[model samples]
Structure formats: structure tokens, C-alpha cells
Target: MDMIVWAGAVLSLAGVAGLVWCILYVMRLRRKALDDATMRSRMQKAVLVNFAALAVSTLGLMMVVIGIFLS
Candidate 1:
């Protein structure tokens, strides 16, 4: 249970980092003034990263909850 909690913490931190990255990336993109197609392409990739990061964060939260319950 302790191990599970620690692992969940690590995963949550990783997801937070990813979310920060997505924020920065979008800010940078906004500053770029790119064409519509180009911006859309980049945004598509960011959307995928955002979804995966969200999933990881959610799973990490679930793991923490489960660990607490089991302990």
C-alpha cells in the first residue's frame, strides 16, 4: 500500500508536469502567429498529449484512493 501510494504520487507529479508543458506550448503557439492549417496541426498533437496526461493523473488519483482504502 505504501508502494502504491508512492507510485501514485510520482505519476501525479508527472501528469502535472505534462499539463504545465501543454500550457507553455499553447502559449508559445499563440505567440507564433502561424497559418490556420499549421496551427490546427499543432493543436491536434497537443490535444492528444492533454488527454493522455489527464488519464494518467486520473489513474494516479484512483490509485491513491485505492491504496488508502486497502491500508
Candidate 2:
């Protein structure tokens, strides 16, 4: 159970890091003043990453809860 909790914590941290990366990437894109088509293309990729990060975070939280309950 403790191992599960720890693993979940690690996963949560990774997810958070991914989210931060996405934010910084978008900010950099915005500063570059790219054309609409380029910006849209780039933003679409970011959106995919953002959703994946959110899913990972959610899974980690669920793991943490289940670990605590089982313990």
C-alpha cells in the first residue's frame, strides 16, 4: 500500500511537470507571433498533451485514494 502511494505521488509529479511544460510551450508560441495556421497547429498538439497530463493526474489521485483505503 505504501508503495502504491509512493508510486502515485511520483506519477502525480510527472503529470504536473508535463502540465507546466505545456504552459511554457504555449507561452513561447504566443511570444513568437506565429501565423494563424501555425499557431493552430501548435496549439492542437499542446491540447493533446494537456489532456494526457490531466488523465495521468487523475489516475494517480485515484491510486492514492485506493491505496489509503486498502491500507
Each prediction's TM-score against the native? Answer: 0.97, 0.96
**Candidate 1: residue 17 lDDT (0-100):** 88
Q: lDDT score, residue 7, model 1?
A: 90
Candidate 1 C-alpha lDDT tens digits along 1-71: 98898898888888888898899999999999899999999999999999999989988888888889999
The number of clashing residue pairs in model 1 is 0
Candidate-wise lDDT, in order: 0.90, 0.92
**Backbone clashes in model 1, listed as residue pairs:** none
RMSD of each: 0.5, 0.6
lDDT of 1 at 36: 100
Clashes of 2: 0
In candidate 1, what residue range of length 10 has the lowest lDDT sum?
A: 5-14
